[model samples]
Target chain A: MASKTALYDQHLAMGAKVVDFGGWDMPLNYGSQIEEHNKVRTSAGMFDVSHMTIVDVTGADAAEYLRYLLANDVARLEVKGKALYSGMLNEDGKVIDDLIVYRMTDPGVSGEWFRVVVNCATREKDLRWMAEQAARFDVALTEQPELSMVAIQGPEAIVKVKSVLNESRGRLIDSLSVFQGQESEGWFIAKTGYTGEDGLEIIVPEDEVADFWRALAEAGVAPCGLGARDTLRLEAGMNLYGADMDESVSPLVSAMGWTIAWEPESRKFCGRAALEAEKAAGVTQKLVGLVMDTRGVLRGQQKVIVEGVGEGEITSGTFSPTLNVSIALARVPAGTGDQAVVDLRGKQVPVAVVRPPFVRNGKKVFS
Target chain B: MSDIRNELKYVASHEWIRDEGDGTVTIGITDHAQELLGDVVFVELPEVGSDVATGDDAGVVESVKAASDVYVPVSGEIVEVNNQLEDSPELVNSDPYGDGWFFRIKLSDASELDDLLDAEAYGELCEDES
Candidate 1:
C-alpha cells in the first residue's frame, strides 16, 4: 500500500483521480487538468505538497555543514528566512537531489538553524547521505514528517490566502518578500512556489491541514492536483528532479549551472573538484526549451534530431496549457542550432529551440 | 459513471461505432475512455485512404497526463477524419458522440458490426475494469 497525505480523504471526496506518485497515493486531477492548470494561471489554485520532505539542520556547524553539503553557497543568505535553491551533489558532481534551504537564523552565527526541503522520492537516499555527511560536522538533522504543506499559487493567491488566515498571520504574510519565509502560530509560511506565480507555501501541523485545505477551497482557491503542478512547473521552465535531472546527470548539463557558486574558490563543496574538471573538459550537452506549434504533443523520452549535431533526448515534455502549444525540455548537443526535429511516432516534427522558462508571471516570455 | 448510448455499438477496447447505412461508419471513443484520458490536448488521425484492420492501432489521443492509442474497432478503409480535432482536441471530452467523432470508415466487412457489444455488454465491461 502507498502512503497517504493528511488530506487524502478530502481528495477522494472532491472526485480526484488518485495515482501512485513517489510512493505516495496523491491526486493526479479532480476532473479536467486543463481547467486546473488555467486556474493557477488565471486565478488561484492550491496543491497538497505534503509529500515533500522537510529537514531541519541545527547545530554550531549548521552553516558550515550546508556549505560543504550543497553545490550553492549558503553563506550568501544574509538575512533570516531567506531561501536558496541548491543541488546536493555526489562526489562525482552528479546531483543526488535539488533542494531549497532556508536560513532560520542570522548568517555566521553559531548554533544557527537551516531548513531544507527535498523531493519526497529521494527521501531515503537523501537522508542517509545527509547523516553520513553530518558525522563529520557538529550538526543534527531532524526530519519534519509531522508537517503538511499546501502551495497556493497564482495572481490572486496571496489575497485568497490572506482572507483565510488570521489577521496577524495575514499581516505577516503580507509583509513577506519573495523567497522569504517565517514561522508564526506554529506554521511556516513561505512566499515561494514552483509555478512562477505569486503565492505562499504554508507548512501546517498534520492534524490541522485538512481544515486549512477546506478553508482554502471555501475561499475559492481551486484544489489542484499533481497533474497541474507538473504542467505549471514545466511552463515556468522549472526542472523536475527525477525527470529533468537524476543521480547520473551533472548539474552543468542540467540547466542548473547557475546554482553552483564558483566564487570564493576556497570553499570546497562536495563535487567541486569533479564539477571543475567537467567545466574544464568543456560541457558537451545543454538543456533547452522546445516549442512545437504544429500538431502532436511532445513527450519525454522522445528522440530529438538536431541537423549536423549529435542526437539528444527530451527530459520533460508536455502540452503547455498557457501557450496552447506543446513544449519540452531536451538535453541536446552543446552546439546544437536553434531548431531540431522530434521523432513523434516515426513522423519527424520540427520544433524551435530557445532558452527555458517558456512562461513566467502568467505570460509567455519566449517569442 | 459514464453514459452508454443505446443507439451506438461498442467494443471492449472502448470505441463506439455508428453505422450510417451508406456502407460508412462513424467512430469515436466512449465517454468512459475520454474520462479516463482526462482533457484531450492533441489527436493524430489516420489518413483518408489508409487501410486499418480491427484491433490495429489507427490513431492517437494525447491528454495532459499521457497518450493513448485509439484502436480501430472494425476492418475498413479510412474515408474521413475529424479535422477540427487537430486544432481543438477538447471536443473529445466535451462532445465525444457527435463533433468528437474520430473518423469515418468505409466498411470492408459489414458483418464485423454484429461482433460488437451492445450498450449493456459494454457497460458490464466498463464495470469489470473498474
Candidate 2:
C-alpha cells in the first residue's frame, strides 16, 4: 500500500489525479498539467512537498561533520538561516544525493545546529549514510518526519503567501533573502524553491498543515502537483537526481561541478580525492541543454548523435509550457558542437545545443 | 465527466467516428480520451491519402505526461486532416467533437461501422476503467 501525505484529502477534494510516486500516493495533477505549469509561471501556485525527508543535525560537531559529508563547504555559511546547496557523495565521487543544508546556529560554536532536506526516495540510504558519518563526530541526527512542507512559487508568490500569514510572520517572510530561512512560531519558512521563480517553502508541524493549506487556497494560490513541479524544475535547468545522474556518474559530468568546492585544497571531503583525480585526468562527457528545431517532442533515453563526435543520451526532456517549445538536458561528449541530431522514432531530427535555464522569472532566458 | 454524443460511434480504445452521410466518416478521439491525456501538446496526423485498417495505429498524441497512439476505427483512405492541430494541439482538449476532429476518411467499406459501440456501451467501459 502507498502512503498518503497530510493533505491527501485536500487533493482529492480538489479533483487531483492521484498516482504512486516513490511508494507515496501523491497528486500528479489537479486538472491540467499545462495549466498548473502556467499558473506557477504567471501567478502563484502551491505544492504539497511533505514527502521530502527533513533531518536535523545538532551537536558540538555539526558543522564539522557536514563539512566532511558534503562535497560543498558548509563553512561558507557565516550567518544563521543561510542555506547551501551541496551534493552528498560516496567514496567514488558519485552523488549519493543532492540536498540543501540550512544553518540553524552560528559557526565555530558548541551546540551548533543544521537542517538538511533530501529527496524522499533516497530517505533510507541517505539517513543511513548520515548516521554512519555522524558516528565519528559529536553530533546527534534526528529525522523530523512529523513535519509537512508546502512550496508556494511564482512572481506573485511572496505577496500572496503574506496574505495568509500573521503580521509578525509576514514581516519575517518579507525580511528573508534568497536562499535564506528562519524558524517562526514552530514553522520554518525559506525563500528558496526548485522553480526559477520567487517563492517560499514552508515547513510546518503535520497537525497544523491542513489548515495552512486551506488558508493558502483561500488566498488564491493555485494547487499544483508533481507534474507541474517536474516541468518547472526542468525548465529552470535544475537536475533530477536519479534521471540526470546517479552513483555511477560523477559531478564533473553531471552539470554539478559548481557544487563542488575545490578551493582550500585541504577540505578532505568524502569525494575530494576522487574528484581531484577526475579533474586532473579531465572529463569526457558534459550535460547540456537542447532545443528541438523540428516539430517533435524530445524524450529521455533518446539517442543524441553529435556530428563527428560520440553519441549521448537525453537525461531529461519535456515540452516547456512557458516557452511553447520542446527542451531537453542531454549528456553528450564534451567536444560536441552547437548542433546535434536526435533519433526520434528512427528519424534523425536536428536540435540546437545551448546553455540551460531555458526560462526564468516567467520569461525566456534562452535565445 | 465528459460529454458523449449519442449520434457518434465509439471504439473500446476511446476513439469516436461520425458518418458524414456521403460515404465518408469523420474520426476523432473522444472527450474522455483528451481528459485522460491531460493537455495535448502535439498531434501527428497521418497523410491525407493514406489507407488505414481498423485497429491499426494511425497517428500519435503527445501530452506533457506521456504519448498515446490514436488508432483507426474503420478501414478507409484518409481524405482530410485537421491541420490546425500542428500549431494548436489544445483543440483536441477544447473541442474534441468538432474542430478537434483528427481526419476524414472515404470509407473503403461503410459496413464496417457496425463493429463500433454505442455511446452508452462506451460510457460503461469508461466507468469500469475508473
Specify the CAPRI tier of model 2.
medium
**What TM-scores does chain A show, candidate by candidate in order?**
0.99, 0.99
Over all chains combined, what TM-score does candidate 2 have? 0.96
Once fitted onto the true fold, the runs of candidate 2 whose alpha carbons sit more than 4 angstroms away are B1-7, B119-130
| C-alpha TM-score for every candidate | 0.96, 0.96
Which tens-of-lDDT digit does each residue in B36-119 have in candidate 2? Answer: 887899999999899999988889999887778999999999999999999889999899998998999899998898889999
Tens-place lDDT per residue, model 2, A90-112, is 99999999999999877777678
lDDT string for model 1 (A140-193, tens) is 999999999999999999999999889999999978888999999999999999
Query: How well does model 2 score by local distance difference test?
Result: 0.92
Provide the TM-score of chain B versus the true chain B for each model in turn.
0.98, 0.98
Specify the CAPRI tier of model 1. Answer: medium
Residue pairs with colliding backbones in model 2 are: none
lDDT of 1 by residue, B43-65 (tens): 88999999999999988999886
